[model samples]
Target: MPSQSAVGSIETKGFPGVLAAADAMVKAGRVTLVGYIRVGSARFNVNIRGSVSEVKTAMAAGIAAVEKTEGATLESWVIIPRPHENVDTILPIHYTPESEIYRQRVEGGGAPLQSLPGNS
Candidate 1:
């Protein structure tokens, strides 16, 4: 799975549905979480790794499923590779931000706010 190692990373936004999708992948042995999935109200990101086909398939299906759930919005996604796939490096920095705007908006335990009409 070397060539497939870093086909790239996938991210999805949603809540329990997204969570359930991740759960299904794990249960089905399709992919594994390489790290923590950023949890928030406005958005969330889950990192997954596995065979290329399964990775992409699960991501698409999962995101779609989550988006269909109540209180969820599909954001952006990309197939960017993981850092240092073959270089064998050590993590020297934290990638997640605790003070990010998304986190702030999602704080206080209520659902995150959606953009106002005409705000784009």
Candidate 2:
């Protein structure tokens, strides 16, 4: 990850909203989807990281997605332009091994991973 990348998050009232947000976010910008968090009581959060401008763009798309979801609501969101390193160390926002594949592909000039066809 670049030292200057930004981190952003969208909190939604339901899993459907968060899922919508995550999909729109990555498609809207060259951002990496870190992961989702279950914040209890049916609430969830979608976290992402990318350039400051890209993060801002992704946040907009994500918020729109949440609003469009049938039974979901956007609760809150945030974008940290240059969060301190310690924040990455302690927060679940940091990329995991599973997500690293996408990051690596993006950095290596390859497209991010996509779903494979299901077996019959």
Candidate 3:
């Protein structure tokens, strides 16, 4: 399988903060809002995929949004450019049906990896 593109993630303390971060990320850059993982302890991680620069832009926006939200704590954030295909399959960072449109818009060329079916 082909390797996946860059991936960015922002972990926030609550659902609302993560929601805000997701919105900010999409609006701030040409990045796909792949999915969010809900870790235990009420934390959620918003993930996006794009070019390295775009991923960085999106992550910055996400972090800012998380910081600005009341009662929301930014636990962590990361950007992995050109991640291994194994990581794509093994981690919860792949695109979903819901994010296909955004992926298309951001990628703007070849198709992305087959989206994991169902809601993320």
The 0-to-1 C-alpha lDDT of every candidate, in the order given, reads: 0.48, 0.87, 0.84
Residue-level lDDT of model 1, residues 5-36, one tens digit each, is: 43223345555655755555444435544544
Model 3 misplacement above 4 A? 1-4, 109-120
TM-score, cand. 1 vs. native = 0.51
lDDT of 3 by residue, 17-100 (tens): 999999999999988888888897989988888888888988899999999999999999889989888888889888887777
Candidate number of the best lDDT: 2
Give me the displacement of residue 90 in model 2, in angstroms.
0.3
Q: Pick by TM-score: which candidate is best?
A: 2
* Regions of candidate 1 where Cα sits further than 4 Å from its true position: 7-14, 24-29, 39-41, 81-120
Q: How close is candidate 3 to the true structure, as a TM-score?
A: 0.83
Residue 76's lDDT within candidate 1 is 56
Worst 10 residues of 1 by lDDT: 91-100
Model 2, stretches more than 4 Å misplaced? Answer: 108-120
| Model 2 vs. true fold: TM | 0.88
